[model samples]
Target: MNSSASSVVDPAAPPRSNPIRIGVSACLLGREVRWDGGHKRDRFVTDGLGRFVEFVPLCPEVESGLSIPRPTLRLAGEIDDPRLVFGDSGADYTEVMRSFARARLHTLADLDLCGFILKSDSPSCGLERVRVYGKGGMALRKGRGLFAAELAARFPLLPLEEEGRLNDAKLRETFVERVFAYRRWLDFVAAGVSLARMVDFHRIHKYLLLAHSPEHYAACGRLVARGKALSRAELREQYGELFMRGMARAATRGRHTNVLQHMAGYFKKQLDAASKDELHRTLDDYSDGLVPLIVPITLIRHHVRVFGLAYLEEQVYLAPHPKELMLRNQV
Candidate 1:
């Protein structure tokens, strides 16, 4: 995954401060734990994204005492009541897997994981469109893997994705953004969340939320403003849920362009005629699909430094994850 030369750090960019903890399917990290003792190592995940976060690699089958090169397993019966069983022998291991998932997730709950990336199309790890087979040997692609289903049900708000889907630029950006935001929320709580702190949190993430869903931004603001009536626990729980949910929506190019325009306005007083024109042109190029998102974002960041715009400099929307990952360059 470490394909390129070392990345040159951006001076205006924030220091690599936050360390997001994420769970990855063990095989994706190049562990030979698959059914045939082969691994689906994802270089982008291990080399690119791995630079920013600490990965907790997990293998449900191996951890559940299943031997490598074991008989292939599949989900059988109705979609709602599918059993994890050997495909050829019809040997049921539903309880074995479910029991392992339950105990394993209980341990993970305390790890404060921000997200998980599972192996795609795996009998025990896939998330979307997994095949479910019936007694008549008919198959439907509507099933979720046993371990992945448990993880989703337990931590409904945690960002989760398949290694295969991360190939898509939009989904990759959305997941990485959510992971950082989720960690920020966790850090807020760890610092002893207070009314004033929550307000500051909402303020910093305001534009970021607007890029995802303006309605959610307004709803979150209302939640914070009406915090006087709710208990501290209630405020913490409700606001956390809304904040994460808001960030979960994929930000569209139109929405991003609007946010860029809004952000550019902050430099109106400081930028000279030439500088303003250059910034506007860069943004237009990005909006017109002629340039990557990093172009406009870099310009805005430079202005933020030159103009001493402390507020915008501190805003997480500008640099959601590590620039070393070069995530924005792709999106």
Candidate 2:
């Protein structure tokens, strides 16, 4: 538990005024920008997550001066430094694509993007497992797409995921959670970096970080404890890196159960025997995989409200993203 006596403010308060912005592949949003002039529209990306975020769509191939219905392109040569070339004629477009990516990434830096959704298996946008061909025309799925590589290099901390990978419930929830957390971090930085604000930020995110990574949570707590001795810039950079890295880690059943138990401690004196038994059963059910995460979380939320546990209420672990997304329903 956080030792700070400061009042905890809701981290989600900032984004309520400003829309969360996310960068995405245009084709995933139902744009006809693919090589075949047809879009690989993902309903989840278009109709589901689209409700909360404003997407900044980009098509690397089309935006890089390539025509619609253009010849197919593949990556060839060294896996580390592959060349983007036309499939039939092997016409190289490595420099053209790289140059475009550099300039376009510069423009995107100003958008304050919270996350990005890329096209899977694309020569220009795949996050990983992109096919790279050898001298004999044999291909290996070990290369990352050109534009995706650049985007990653430029914004190492930004939350990024391939559209196809979002089909998995756990991965989808983690990615969306990171997106909202990243936005909250951005909001914190924009407000100003001070020891007080840093302490408040660390206090609110304590449980959320513990579920993902207990090690990082402890590390961040130590940093905040001694923040007065460190420069503000050093504190901010280190904390931001640790926070995002922790969030990137997948929160497993055991870790989540640990957090739930820790949160339950707050309501120890307030709950009667039957209420406590009910909470324990819900936690056990969640641990045994008899119910989804939403079940246990809903009970905990109800207890928090009934007891008016201000600290637990401020914790982002209960409501990381919008409840309408139902990310916790499946996981």
Candidate 3:
């Protein structure tokens, strides 16, 4: 994690009661299990996000019976259907890796994972832009690792990102937000599904959904409205799909500004003229890139408490992830 992000958790902020379960590349946690017996340990994944999440680490190459300090492997052949081959020996491990991944992912599905963090540019775990060499020995950075591709195909809605990409402030924020949200959804389902409970979940996440995609928010609202008519299984399936799709979209500045303005309306009858002016100015500053999102969010949260806006106080958008991550400070 960046130093700025590391310092954001308020001392008095309510601690999360439940830990989010996430899959991660084993080497990211400082395990010496890479092909060369060296780890690509990422402090952001291990020290920052790790504080809030329980990682289920796996090293495909090592777990598949490959020796440490083994000959390096590379993806070769067609981009869509690459073969995992030793860099120097031309030995093939494609089928072995695929079979191992299929079995491992099936096991993971039972683990109730909310997200996954893969190692970047790994032959076994990179999520994107992995180099695939052509028959003539030229490399193209358009392929995903075999295991990463399998995991995605198996759990299409599961939040997944590479440790390398998590270095970006925006991507890191979105990934952390989605993981926590997914964990909440899982807990909701585990508590037993009901139309009334579905409505309650939708209500709390309204503005959070709006920040990502207005169309998805509308679709999800409509889905909840039909809750009493649809069977429990059908309602759960459809709602989960829409919820995941909506959060999968990056929350852009324009969309967030609109939501922030809408939230500010709740405090209009409660704020004095000066306070109102300050709120609007903060929102405008955030919208104009002159201030971080945390500025408007912090002000709105204060107003919500002062005015006792119960509904607004409960909104997940106000505290999507742990404040300690300081994700909004970056965006």
- Candidate No. with top TM-score: 2
Prediction 2 global C-alpha lDDT? 0.91
lDDT of 3: 0.87
Q: Give the TM-scores of the predictions, in the order they appear.
A: 0.92, 0.95, 0.93
- How many clashes does the backbone of model 3 have? 2
Report the C-alpha lDDT of model 2 over 124-191, residue by residue, as the tens digit: 99999999999998999999999999999999999999998899998999899899999999888988
Question: What local lDDT score does residue 261 receive in model 2, on the 0 to 100 scale?
Answer: 95
Give the Cα-based TM-score of candidate 3 against the true structure. Answer: 0.93
Q: Per-residue lDDT tens digits of candidate 1, residues 34-145?
A: 9999999999889988877889999999999989988899998989868999998999998999999999999998787989999988879999888999879999998999
In model 3, the runs with Cα more than 4 Å from the true position are: 1-18
- Candidate 1 lands at a TM-score of 0.92
**Candidate 1 clashes between residue pairs 3 or more apart in a chain or in different chains:** none
Q: Which lDDT tens digits does candidate 3 get at residues 159-189?
A: 9999989999988988888888888888888
